[model samples]
Target: MPKNKVYIFDTTLRDGEQVPGCKLNTKEKIEIALALEELGVDIIEAGFPISSPGDFKSVSEIGAVIKNAVICGLSRAVQKDIEVAAEALKTAKRSRIHTGIGTSDFHIKSKFNSTREDILQRATQCVKWARNFTDDVEFYAEDAGRTDNEYLARVVEAVIAAGATTVNIPDTTGYCLPHQYGEKIAYLINNVPNIDKAVISCHCHNDLGLATANSIAGAMNGARQIECTINGLGERAGNTSLEEVVMVINQHHSLGFYTDIKTQQLNPLSRLVSDTMRMPVQPNKAIVGANAFSHSSGIHQDGFLKDAQTYEIINPEQVGADGSKIVLTARSGRSALAHRFQKLGFQFNRNDIDVLYEQFLKVADRKKEVEDEDLKVLANQYQTATV
Candidate 1:
């Protein structure tokens, strides 16, 4: 059977930059945009053009230089917002206008102080206005995770009719469980008559730490595009991580999905975004974290040394990361100690290691981790005693 193509829509410059103090200048945005193009992102959501003068300039600059990837500018359902986005994306080879309005009752009654019918009309109208500027238009139903599935389908169907090529169902508040998000996508696929006319997209947030899982669930059900960021950087918790979603589909072949992303660039691009945005990726972050491939636990280290596949599903070099590290710590066993010693050019026999293990444990217990210099001291002292 043929694998389905899952379009990677990267929103690092737009949504990911929304994190407080993670803002990027136009030069930084362009740099990341070109890298994202090289990384084979299908669509790069450059910025919200109407948000500010700086944002409009960034989107315009990114659109002018980004040739291969579809450069996209975001906007609200307002006409002025869509117009600004269209003007900003005028120089791109391929451009998309992403415009949408909130659909949930919380947004409808409290946020917009309007009824569902008015919001629905605004949603379709925005797509129509966006269609005037570009053939590629993506309509998002903000907070669709909490929206009624039936009403959400109506909004989706209307947007497609209004010339939306992609329909984004965002877990704006990150409120849905994996099952709920998947079932919601399935509901639209089953209920909407014109659903096949447009691609279903998953734009999930990581408030509950289920953004990646929810995105996968949506894809499994019917979504063909996943909107995500480089390092899961965004408002509140974060957005679905680009590395996580791409690697997940790569590892789980039974899902029968494939993306055009270059796997090796994941780490380099991740670090670039993290540094440029000044947001630190958590050490335990999946795929691109500092400790993602480092083994320190004695059981895990021994298993990893014996066979890398025993503890690591991903080879570090596969993602352009440095080789796996065997960090020596208090919990490390003799096998790990021997391996580290071997790496340091020491030819310790099993008996040599047996004697050194006692002293190594004493040093390890005194510190958080046993450094190479500490190991050398132990090796030298043991050799002196044996001689």
Candidate 2:
């Protein structure tokens, strides 16, 4: 991979499905896996094979069909988990086994009641076991955001030496700020002796609503892969949003990084995942959100009417969205109302709009938004009064 290339690792089938009530069956998982491939994701984490029989079947079936992108299965540091993950990925043209353990003291002491040395050994052994079945092995440091840098670097080095091709540093609890996460990635890059041997991946959560920001920070600090999900779906708040991160790297040229993602497929794929998982994308969410390209404020609408660049940084059509909307609300100005009417095929002049503006505002005040039907009624009422 090029130094500036960032790999897109989509874990919607595994992590995103972990969200409550977002469970997907084999067919749904395969549907998303194929779509992710078409969207140009570098890797698809099909499922955690050892978690359930259904998940095992989904991973196996997705691995069997997906040809271009690498199919991966999640596993713990346990031997059986690695074995099951390997079996699930047997049919993939490209396959990866992602296995790891907790490296943070909080998890080490509380979750496993083990010391650093024991955990480090377990991490190395798991990677070695994964290597037995496939060369594309990724090791994740669970709760790495909270793990101490020196100790984290040690485990990272040990894993790479043990045959891991990618190392994931996850902000498991969505705890780290951008600067903190960036510094952590930088620390590993500078301190780890064999850091260049494998790719550093960022897996951030959105509890603080900073998953996208933190993931960008990681990429800026030399992490080459971003682990994300469609529509930001995951356990708790969510993981880093795939569309948000992909667009961020694309729009900001100064970042000097790029991914293989097909930007135009973002919205359609977001909707597919949302519909398949029975989860609604928040209207206000970034990128593929319903309100992402909408102009509602009077000031914004006026500026957007004059020049779209003034209010919108991203074109709606760039991400497969319908188009920019001039939503008529009480906050809208006469310019926006005129624009909406013009779009509705009404040739209302400034004087005609001025006459109808009062009634438009009356209806706008009564309703949250004045629709085209309301504008037609107002226009007809104005023409009747004049006649």
The global C-alpha lDDT for each of the candidates, from Candidate 1 onward, is 0.94, 0.94
Once fitted onto the true fold, the runs of candidate 2 whose alpha carbons sit more than 4 angstroms away are 1-3
RMSD of every candidate to native, in Å, equals 0.7, 1.2
Candidate 2, residues 50-71: lDDT per residue as tens digits? 9999999999999889989999
Counting only residues 3 or more apart in sequence or on different chains, how many pairs clash (N, Cα, C under 3 Å) in candidate 1?
A: 0
Using Cα atoms with residue i matched to residue i, what is each candidate's TM-score against the true structure? 0.99, 0.98
Clashing pairs in 1: none
lDDT of 1 by residue, 1-387 (tens): 999999999999999989999989999999999999999999999999999999999998888888799999999999999999999998889999999999999999999999999999999999999999999999999999999988999999999999999999999999999999999999999999999999999999999999999999999999999999999988899999999999999999999999999999999999999889888889999999999998999999889888999999998888888879888988999999998899889999999888899999899899998999999888888778888
Looking at candidate 1, what is the lDDT of residue 117? 93
Worst window of 10 by summed lDDT in candidate 2: 1-10
Model 1 CA RMSD to the hidden true structure, in angstroms = 0.7
Give the per-residue Cα lDDT of candidate 1 at 26: 91
